[model samples]
Target: MAVPNAASHLDFVVDPEHPDAEPFYAPSKRNYPQAVKGFYRSIKWAALVATLATYYLLPFVRWNRGPGAPGQAVLLDLADRRFYFFFVEIWPQEAYYVAGLLVLAALVLFMMNALAGRVWCGYLCPQTVWTDLFFAVERRFEGDLHARRAREAKGWTFDRAWRLVAKHATWVLIAWWTGGAWVLYFSDAPTLVRALATLQAPAIAYVWIGILTFTTYALAGHMREQVCVYMCPWPRIQAALTDEWALNVTYRTDRGEPRLSLKKSHAARSRGEPAGDCVDCRQCVAVCPTGVDIRDGLQLGCIQCGLCIDACDAVMSKVGRPARLIAYDTDMNVARRAEGKPALRRLVRPRTILYAVAIAAVGSLMLWRLTTRPGGALAIAHDRNPLSVTLADGSIQNGYSALVINRDAAPRTFDLSASGVPGAKLVVEGAPSDGTRVRIQVPGDDTREVRVLLRAAAPSGAATSVPVTFTVVNETSGETATATDRFETPAAN
Candidate 1:
């Protein structure tokens, strides 16, 4: 053995003055969570029912878009490159709406983070939903935690083997149904279901179903908590976004410290000695889905599910003490209670205000743009080969490709007009015009491209390039759309 150093003796001095000394920490142990029932569980059940219903039913809901347009209420028609959501229709050119929706979603998530910890992860995430279903299957076949543990200890038997098979069969069925439901959103659900039953569905559809089935089974059944703890980036982002005032699953250390066994604590109380309310029962840890011990301080693994609170409340009721030993609380409040100070909360902080403002601003902007958008559209692409052509009539000519889009339910006439060069003659190849404007008949919900020729009577104007505007005005609605281009002429060397 080596001789003890003077530094070792100094380490024993009560409360050292050094600020950089690291505290000892132990790695967390894995917990096998037990089942419980309470108010939070009831709320979780309601959420599951609502979310799953909305997801699997909303696609089949129908909307009338008149003739020639798809009737599906919620559809992403990739073939036509259109996204239809009830009353709103998004074209490939209007991808900004999708971006706006994504921004709104992110802001909502941030607002939720500001109000509560990872409540979304525990209650609303798809990982949580599917895993809960898998767990229910496990319980139905293998029994609850106690019976499952006992069965595993007894090893494999005919009864156990058959139950295991049943369990896996049920899991696979649920996973397959999940995969099947996802494909319904892309096509007509009833039609696709019939095709699938007749084994006549597209090969690509079946391939996608198989891929989704495997992924769902592996992720929800096999991976479980590993996805939340090790794979997800949301937890880390939430950690950075969270403030001390944000509510989280917390252990009331102020009321539960100086822990002792139930019998010992009761004995100490009877003798007029100080003893904490905690019975060291470990019930809170036993009920945590992520195997986190709330008593160990606020940690990343805590999903703020409130199951531990239920477990501790049950324990407290049994012991004839007040509940809420483990409950939703804030770090600032916990610290205040520890320091014998009044609790303080600030929900209207800068971060929350910023998120709310951004969400409102983006939502309003998208709504305004959608409401005021014109029914007609125009685009012009100037020919690049020769830049400008010298016609036999001693005039400079510019060629362009013009596209006119009609976004209505009936055929509409649009007057196509161009302006830039004075005394320029305009001609549409496939249609006749009244010199200055052309009448183009555009079909309902369709776009038409036409070749346009612009001839300047002469190059006497002096400029080599000039700005040009192409306008298309719907004759019925008087709605107009304009696109800009440049008129190019040959250089005078």
Candidate 2:
């Protein structure tokens, strides 16, 4: 039998009663995050500047696309059914490219999750960035967290009333600018700006601007963290994707347990007794935007922004303890510490490998298809009402609608011909024929449709179905496109 002291060598906390062993579940309180400076804070600041600049300025950038094309660098011209991004123009038939882009975006999100937990939510998400800006405005007009708290504690005052009004006025201006910037992408920015200044812009523009302004104010100014905690699906999906190795904002209970006041901790240490480093200062909680006590364990409310880390580090520096009581750490490290072993970190996992492979594969496929896509196309549709007609001379005639698309931005002529049936002749209605072929000029960046009649001199006992080929040959470049259709005949055999 093991002695009591020998058994105590194993690292297990003995609870005299079961009351303290229940699972942790605390009702969330509203967090009024205090500002702090650290590496993560600097990163957040840089991201804010970059993202906001891109959003508000990209629509005004110019891209010269020769003549008769919209010059905006990035635009979605709904009136013309065209999406222009620099040199690439997408038409209605290329909507699959947008679907592919969405798939690529999802894969990138998963990869970010596999590598770092909710880094996108912390820094890059529009909600987070906009809320951060609104908070800054609130601080500028109302003062820091404590000042606002004091003002709220007091009764209504004229000074407070004015400050409140000023703050809201600022918020509305920002929200309006945010909404106004969005509509510029759909039309010519300079023309729209002049029209809007003269109060002559389209009614649809005003309607969209009003809708977006209201939503931005409501979501960024009022909803704030509530949007992240209860409204977003990403949190649930992130929870599912996270693994033991992924770093999350966590509390190091091993270094912070048995928390006490600073004086009591010093007294305990003087007597050569064990005392944890944390003095229970509550600085981490005070600075957490989500009001999460990271020491309790990883919680869903934490956006993994590392603000608490900055707060706790400042506290540690003032109290003469090491920093990072709160940090981006893995659960595996926690378990290892509990087991009296060194922590391990692993970022190369199967999930990350899979995401990387998918990104690369899909990217390569898109590039290959874009580079090798056909520059011209031909389509043939046979007439349904009268599939075939027997002329007075006993020759079988078939009517078809032929469409030729010229993708290049240059005027070109194409010769339409028919083959695959012996003595088959082709005639294009409303087109001039040059002896053997019907030649038609197709304007640049457009498609032309022509009615075609195919006459085949065949015996009355011929088969019911015969294969026919219609070919369109570029008169200048000799590039050819062929479409196959069936020539119907009366069953006489």
Each prediction's RMSD to truth: 7.2, 9.3
Query: Model 2 over residues 1-493: C-alpha lDDT tens digits?
Result: 1124422342244344553563232233445677778878888999999999999999999999866778999999999777988877776666887888889999999988887788999899999999889888888888878998888778788878999999899999989999899999999998898998899999999998899899999998887888888889999999998898888888888998788788999999999888888898888887776677877887777888888888888888988999888788888898899999998888778988889999999888877766665556688999886788888999988889998877667878988888777777788888986434898789876678899888887734547878888888888778888899988875522
Provide the TM-score for each candidate, comma-separated. Answer: 0.87, 0.82
Each model's lDDT: 0.84, 0.83
| lDDT value for model 2 | 0.83
Error of 1 at 239 (Å): 1.3
In candidate 2, which residue pairs clash?
none
